[model samples]
Target: MSLAVALALGTALALPAVAFADADDSDNLMRKKRFGQNTGTVTTNSNTGGHSQESGSKATTETAVISDGAITPFITADGAAAMQAVADKYAAVVAQGGWPKVPSGKLKKGSTGKGPAALNKRLFMEGYLRAEATEGEYAQVFTSATEDALRRFQRNHGLSVTGVIDGPTLGALNVPADRRLATIKANIPRLAEYSKDIGNRYIVVNIPAQQIEAVNDGKVYSLHNAIVGRPSRPTPVVMTPLTVIRFNPYWNAPASIVEKDIVPRMTSSGASKVMRDMNMKIFNGVGGPEIDPDSVNWRRAVVDNYHFRQEPGGSNAMATAKIEFNSPFGIYLHDTPEPHLFHTGSRFYSSGCVRVDKVAILIDWILQGQDGINSSRIAELAETKERLDKPVTNSPQLRVAYLTSWPTRDGVAAFRSDVYQLDGTGFVVGQPLPVGETQGGKRYVLKPIPRSLEAVDADEAVGFASIFRRSSDRIDASERLPGASSKSTDSLVSLKDPKAKLKAQGRDTGKKKSKAASNGKTRAWTGNRERSASEVMSMPDADGTTAKKPGSKKVASKKAKSGDKSKTAKAKADEKAKTTKSTKVVKKDKTEVAAKKPDAKAVTDKKKALTDATKTASADSKSATQKSNTAKAAKPADCKAGADGKLPAGCKPAAAAKKPPAKPEKTAATPAKTASSTN
Candidate 1:
């Protein structure tokens, strides 16, 4: 048997065992008819009037059980062959009047009404049920088989897996057969386009399905739930090789985000608060200087021509890991902080990039051959907050494609909403028509998956972590220890005490010094916040340099004090030389003033007169020791004060004691020793 027939027979195999009831259970609604009357048995030769053509044949009619076990990868050659067969089946379905619509009302097991009859007929026409299952029983009765078949239909069509029939389930059921066939026709060319030379190992991202299949050895090795681009910013079709895996990546904000996102937020709230809270930094340009956001003049203009970057941490848009690939659209795959979105059935919530669920698995698969990258090593990297990057030598191929109808390993063609409206086929999320009816020009609106607008990160790094030397990005490499005070302690640093951090901050030696310097300038970052006025006394900047505030005094080194004493002898010699030089300068100035009389004569005469007066005043000033000695000599020994307020001991009146002939002026030409006066 061919692969298609073998696959289709799985549906037929489920047919023979469905016995309606023995009238044993009292609560079963299937016991509506009496047991004695034989309605009739359906066999290969039995003839009964049926609603559809498949109802006539017993063995040839077989439907694809879409929710069956896994099948071949969607991009492989055999998978394409499966799709071709499924398309043929759909075309045959379109040739006939198509399957009947399952009525839109809640129906579970034991439900008996017109709704169940319509549902059973619909399931039977698609080969979900054989004629034997409902044989010799009331046709309107809802059987356990109907619920199971409805679930298969839901899974194939990408609807929520609620087994009972409701609005959404019925909506999928009532879609026109011609429209479904059209969806298959549109994507056949696309499938054929990628059918050849797809490597043995590759990754396929089905955008409409919002699921990723990692095909290894032509089979799915791992499956991941994914969030792709939205309707407005649909993910593009691309074939590229994963080139780089960045651990703890810094998200460089693209220009679109800088204009549409960053600018609007800065306009509403204060720019400073938004940047600091979001842990984002602004750059002068792509691969240019990292500018502090506080330095930007926000009021003067709109946000333009600047590179915005989100620092690596839990707050980053691309949390933890980012996988880089080369594409013209600047698209790549990365892990996200929003892990909860994967739970929803319709997950289309990215700009143009793909966000993978459980991305560590994908990373481990991509880096399989590279050294030091296994499950344990990847976990360590995921927990780390430092940014580190390395090239991927054993990268896998990645293909992102869009399809509204896909044939799975189960041999059934599952359908999805035309989210991007690429196929332009008719498929609605809710019931398109009233019960047991058909219509034309039915409108099917594509609704967006409900998720908040996320702040977008740059698809490509602006080359900041290596070249820009941003302070926030400096943790690119530090021989990262788990934490402080272990055997790995490289410095005497303490978390509570910053002084130790300060001491180690400027000690960029060994490998760091050579790496940070080029052409005699240092561009090494210290990975610390910008130093403030209080921290200026100790902390270093990105250049490994620190500056003291202007006008602040610095304590002189002890060596300078010891040198001053040794220089005392030199000081005396220097004083003598200065005296000689000054006398010559005064004589030359006197001569020049005599020659040129433009206020020079008055200035010279005043200078000379002032010098002479200063000399005379210094000579006349008596020494404090001499004054004390003179007073002692004049006073009589054992002198006592008289009641008459007169000088009793000296036996002379205060008026009669001559004031010792006012001490004669000392030498007028000598200058004072301690206080020097210059003319």
Candidate 2:
């Protein structure tokens, strides 16, 4: 028989046993159905349902047994294939099971549907599974065992302990198996690029999944659902370490956020008052360099002017608590007033910072005080509200970071959305992946297993000599250290103290010097010594040699005697030089004087002639003015108007002498007229 025929024969033999209840349990023989009754003996040929065992007779339907809560065929052969197909779609969820248990309600008997299984797994991956224990003996069943496993899965994946599977779980389970696998594999390429090494303690945020995983010592320490930035303002991808946790942090409004979200909202009528209610501090970003909110035209300005900030207040997006880090991305973890947002499966909703679910729990871990900030004391202080107002002990250190890709337990690459979508997309900064490749159009995908962080010198050098030079300068300037001198050893410590402050400040200071030193001028004090001292000295003389004045010269007798220009004549010259050189060569000998006298006298005579001509012109002008005045005095009295109303037209009464002519009005004199008078 053909292969198809052999399979049909096997089904035929299996069919009869199902109809005969006496073949198995005693309870099965006395079958009384709630909806129907079973009677007598029943027989049927099963070799072929399409044709009868006896020729010329119609084929009869085979009967199935129902007993002991077991159907004759628990599952059809084809149905088993269908179940595997469902499993394939939720491969990511199943893979997560290696670390997490199955969520509650996910494996309940009535809940076992193809769609639900996939969704349950998806919910598990997102850290949103809520599991509850199944009720009754039903919990003892294998199905119940699976449900319990699902609950463990939910807890492991960072979900709440709700036994029943929900829509989130169902969505996770329903992910197509190929797509799920693809997502994992796609991230593999970016594994090495994600972090130098994830370090002993680091955070991993999966954007697609919207969850935060805290891994330490190659194991998951804690997990939490995170509310990431909105699509328009997605979280960025970067590598940073946690260093501080600022409790009751004040929000310094970033300019872009103020422009996009704060300004317009404020300008809309009652915004200022609302912002005041929200404890926001407004600043001006446009009018001047410093952002002064009061200087802004609040009457005409909108809330979106890019200068508003929600100060340290309960309603602020930055929250009362802050996780301080030094990442260029400037992200931090914090608490939110709106804790209910965590309940929903989707938590991606923030400006750029990460909003943590169960933040208090996470704080309990970071603040354990073993290595990082002691968070417990900070929480206590937060309650009292007095610690932040003054100095308080046990402050938590926070370090916010941005990581787009990371590894799974099995070393598979994982990627998250570039929630803050910074312009740069790449492996580090420049090596971006081809478009439509990874989640960020960047190259953070699964690759070879990542290596550990590179070896960096934890022992920082104090650069004592360099530091001493700097301090000595300040000392010379009479400026003391910013603090009062104390006998305490800590008073002498500075940024060089590595125990408390981050390594970033020192590293940055080092880098800044590198570029500045390259030009060679910043450290070229020795190169300009002579030029700098030049101002303190006297001027040079002819022939380009510096001249010594009489005050600087010492009295000395001339051994050579007067310059001998042939004995006697030279004697007088040499004698005179000796005396005059003492006064910067003021003395002149008779021979030298006779030689230059005629030329000097001629120059003097020319100057005297020029002076005499100037004096003669001055005298002539004065005499002319006096003569004119005398003439005016002789003629003015008789030239007045006649009593008969007739006057000499020629004399014109001297125009009453015109009071020496009033000064011309400024308007009457144009620039051209002034130029003519000057000419």
Candidate 3:
């Protein structure tokens, strides 16, 4: 009995171990099906699946996967809940009658128009105006209540809150309820996907809305306006930890900007003018000797081959601070010199980087736990105008996303325009992963890399000048003001050799000769001939020594001959007219004789023939009337006895007459006597 109990205990322990092995195998199969093969190496966890540690390293790996699933690192639980509430509210609004559209015009205080009534109705539906405040049939007057309601609506929709129904306000109000609902539904999944595992502290940048929020402990710590990337150079969606914040950092212009923007400006505006105005310096290469602006060939030196660095100052492109983050696309957040852009309704004007408003506040928040860095230290650095680097000990995670609809913590849902169209139905998927090494030790396959500026064709490297110069060159010289110099002509002259200069002068003389000929000037030719006395008498003498050009004398004589011939032709035409008049008179006389009256005997014969015809017609009418009466009298009665239905004697109906067959025509009779004589 003891031996049997020991075997049973051992079998039970083995069964649990076998079951665990089966579960792990199943998990591996599911992962493979979802994400394909495990081509990448996975770090093992020393604690739980949520956390891991590398061998001999204190750095812990924060697993992206949360309790539910792997998600974008930026979304928070409170944000997702807020979005759900907004979606539900908009759905209910759709169930009821949707919001009314305000008319397409401006509405200010004291204005009495139909647009004001519509605006009031919209505000009431959106819960910005009280029902009692909108009393009356028309509500056409734009009262104080209406202005206050408009202000609230604008604030909620991320507008300027001007308290007037301006163009932007009217546009936001006119968006249909159905579209708003659809936008909410489309973005709800995105919120759920990205907001799943966001920790207690992080930053959220919404590209479509151009806003950023720093959240801590389920609440917004600070909010600021942002200027994101333009459409052509869109800001990429990424989630990475920001590691450093630099004060008064230098701006290294990217290669693309140098090739496309700076090069053209330098070429047109002159290198010295551009560098001085922009506070930029040209270097031979990275960390190489700084070159004098005048020494470089502004016209021929390729901008892509050189490096441009802007000095750190208040006037620099990146105004004062830069927040460093690891991204393969080389993107980051920084401050800008143009702070007025933050007040605009739409602020997408950067070249793939984000420009944050109130960047000092953000830096202070990011460096909360760092050594020797705080708001006071930042202020001191700004006053002194000194460049300083501050490393963030507790680096916060940043998620840049394109979300058009979001909900506030108070359960108020707001919808923004889909500027980037990233709500799944957009042309692009999400922000594309960067091409090179990513933050999580993963590499993304991207399209063929863009060719370097040096690799591009020489003609193409000139950019806009190569495309537009030819068209500008075609403008006529006469259109320019008199005495104005032509830059292109001057450049051409400066480049020409002395031999070419002489040839150009000869060409100009030939052009003048053609112009004289076109003006009808006469040319003189010389020959070995003696001048006759008559020729000399007819021609005009020049100073009594030289005669007039022979060409001019010949032209004058030809004109005289032509005049005499014209006179002879006119005389012949007059003589022909006289002959034609005489012939017309003779023809008229013959026509009068032909048009005389008809003969008298012919008229008398016509009258006699008419009388005979009248008498014959009267006799024929009398005979036809007598014959019709006799036929009517001889008609047979019905073949029936009166009221007895018996046949009458000798009253048979007459039979219809049959037509006789036609006879053959007779042939000409043969002349037998003539035939006998011929024989």
Each candidate's lDDT (Cα)? 0.55, 0.39, 0.55
Name the candidate, 1 or 2, with the larger lDDT value: 1
Q: In model 2, where do residues sit more than 4 Å from their true spots?
A: 1-107, 110-174, 284-295, 298-307, 358-364, 367-376, 386-679
TM-score of each: 0.52, 0.38, 0.50
Steric clash pairs (candidate 1):
71-409
Q: Residue 8 error for model 3, in Å?
A: 51
- Across residues 339-450, which tens digit of lDDT does each residue of candidate 1 receive? 6556655666666678877787777778884787776777776665666786888677887776666676545677767776656443312111211112233322122111
Give the top-scoring candidate (lDDT). Answer: 3
Each model's total of backbone clashes:
1, 76, 1
**lDDT for position 112 in model 1:** 90
The ten-residue window of minimal lDDT in model 1 covers 46-55
List candidate 3 stretches off by more than 4 Å.
1-75, 92-97, 102-151, 162-167, 289-304, 343-345, 421-679
lDDT of 3 by residue, 1-679 (tens): 3222322233222211001110001111112111111112122221221111111122122212123322122257756666777777777777887888788877899878777887787777666777865677547778898887675556556565567776667778888887888887777766765564567888988777676767676555655667787654567665557767778777777665665466556644567877887777888776688987766544345566566777776366656678876554566788776665565655667767888876777777788847877777777665565888776778877777767776653355555666654444431213332221121222211121233433344213222232445543532221122333333442234335875675445444334334333323332111111233334333423223343434666555666655655555555465455544542232223433343333578546655655555566566666767987987677665655546655577455545986632221111112222222221
